[model samples]
Target: MSPELSFSGLSVLVARVAPHTVATVHALLRDGARVTVASSLDDLPTSLRDLAERGLVTLDPRADPTAHDVVLRGDPSTSPAPQPQPRVAPGSPDVGTVTLLGGGLGDPGLLTVAGIEAIRVADVIVHDRLAPLSALRHARDDVQVVDVGKIPRGDFTPQERINEILVEHALAGRNVLRLKGGDNFVFGRGGEEAEACTAHGIPVVVIPGLSSSIAAPALAGIPVTHRTLVQGFTVVSGHVPPGDPRSTLDWGAIARSRTTIVVLMGVATLGAIAETLVAEGLPATTPAAVVADAGLPSMRTARAALGEIDATARREGLGAPAVVVIGEVAALDVLR
Candidate 1:
């Protein structure tokens, strides 16, 4: 007979093994396995009864038997061992290192105090296209600024090469600031760069800034979530893999979900995304909005139905660094 078990935070499966199955389970438990028997009080195996008598396992009668044959619940008190800290080399110059700082969503005023401070203290600033040039005015005149903008399908410094530059400048006793457009950790590949620094025994610090993902939409007067419109929201990366066989996203779930959908770096694949949503049962008339160059003086916004997004974006010339908002909340903007 199958038995189901439930405990604080564990799950276990058991089938008709043998009469001594309970003893085997008990041995496994003593060796640090948390087990629970979910069958009725009268249906427990003899081995389970023995373990229960010894207080090693608990028996609960309220579990479903058909769905789960046997259920073992683990103890929640135990946790894994802590990891050791990385060792730093002796006499390494701590003065020269890299700080990956986030430049907030194209607005110099949006920059945090710490971000401005980093700019003032940096000896060299390695920046991207998204970072506003006005923000750099705070830096010293002698501070070297290197533009490493990665244009799509254009001349660009590879990520590995960028990491090498940061390290080389730091080892040369120069305080380097790796200025990024938005939050470094959010789809910015900052983690990979941080790992590279760690592997080379170079110290790195991260300063997070406002990501354009939400700020861009907000600057365009579009709230990602509204209590009357959307109860929750989901942010996704629109950069799907080339020739990706497996579905990169579950469009059906997103379409059916009553939550706001925000897509970052999705302008190029806008048509495909709209089609996927429509095909997955989202209405073609669903409200959607796109904000381009958000938080900048040249910021432009376009609102349309799901079916009209692709054509509208093309006609309006809305391109990269744009934020896409999809859901009922987008429709409310018309009233505002």
Candidate 2:
């Protein structure tokens, strides 16, 4: 909804049906533009199919994108391979730069001003599933927005392929933005991406975000620490169960730490985590809480003692991309 902007006479071609792509198509249609979505029928979700059925959009995989007034590269895999570029001489002006931006807790409002500026100036944006796609409204109509988000236990873009996409776009003289949810370095694999960019001689910048580890619980009115109850906090990954060989966490030390405990990406294994912590000497009656879909209108919170928190969350139908808090603070809703 920009002032004095209209697409009444334009036809737009969107190359794929990604989450961000769908948002863009809707925006164009709202502006009175005719839109054609190009992708296989199998990739068309019910919403897109509804649009096609109503004759509001033309859905064709073989549509000639050149026929449209505007063509969007919605998915990197669907974009043409970047052609070779003339190498820049040493110490010469760098052609393109990459900005690593964190989206923060699934809310566009949580996205920092610097992050939005980066998006507005980017020629290509490579984003993750948890990142705020709504913020892409700030991007140019022609900016190539690629969805490389990884869904837990589901289809995802390989990290290797994502790295290649960043490098390819930078080498092609396009300013690239690698956007994700939460702080880039907090279990975000941002270090690896930064390293890749440095190795390839691409100038890279990182703008930190509010990590959901702290934000989610706060939004749910549960503080991770309180001066009288806990002096510090420990953030852990619950993606792997306690007994899994892949897990290097010392559940014993964590349980004995006697500090606020915040677990991220641990919803699926909360039962095992609680059991291990209690067996390792933590009190079974310790207060625990789960905040799901943080920073969203549908966000829900579930709370129980350490011994029953997992079942409580399950009974409440709460799921992942959640923050699990265990400590005295979980029993207090300071905001309430």
Candidate 3:
């Protein structure tokens, strides 16, 4: 007989039908072992047949064990009893929490597992226009997916309204997932949203995602920094909001510095940016490249001299969701 088998907790034995001898030898008669056989009904051994008659085992006559299970039916004792998990009670402050998820560089594959899980469990999702739609496929069928995408000089839901929506959903006992493109903390205004949730005493979680600032240029075969080519890199937002006191950036110094410049959301200001750099003594001939829809299959990149960057990008018709890399490393693409 097989050695006394102790399954510690209630456990079921699931086996294929092809191995008849192995199933029969252990058929509900091993040393103090509660064995169950799953094989063809006609192939069951006498011992197994007797066990079935005595209720020690059950024969699933309707099942084709050759194709799936053959002999044993569901184990009465071994079947685990459904146990409820403890969760926040209704009306609890954290009962319906909000999660701020970073969708990562426009590539659904780049999303972290935690971000995917949050989407799957979310009662509602407020996503930016640039976030990959493929990432939302895992969500429940009835999930409420909202588009809060922002466009320049275009219709958009105000940030305050978006914040209110998040809070309203949580207060109504619904989980909310606020999904944004790229790293939430990296110019995505994720910090501001978190502050809003905290101010309302709503529980919140944040997931980091890949940033386009570095990924975009790298995908275009341009390294942001190299031991000999460029020592360091700096990421700056090209967007300047109206009436903002801290709108000014030292473009002259940035242009003259040795560090490579990676600008996000700068497509609209390319001409002025190029002009400023040239005026600041950076050579007009300095190599520069712009990559749009980085990390996506439909990505487009263009290379040009500092003086002709604006025209080159325009001629190529590169749109938003692009990153601009400026430095000697940008020239390496010409060699290939």
Output the number of the TM-score-best candidate.
2
* Residue pairs of candidate 2 with colliding backbone atoms: none
Query: What overall lDDT goes with each candidate model?
Result: 0.70, 0.82, 0.70
lDDT of 2 by residue, 216-269 (tens): 999999888898899999999999999999999999999999899999999999
What are the per-residue Cα lDDT tens digits for candidate 3 across 244-321?
Answer: 366677887787788999889888888878888788888999999999878655478999998998899999888776
Cα RMSD (Å) between model 1 and the true structure?
23.5
lDDT of 3: 0.70
Task: Report the candidate with higher lDDT, 2 versus 3.
Answer: 2
Q: CA shift at 63, candidate 3, in angstroms?
A: 49
Error of 1 at 174 (Å): 1.7
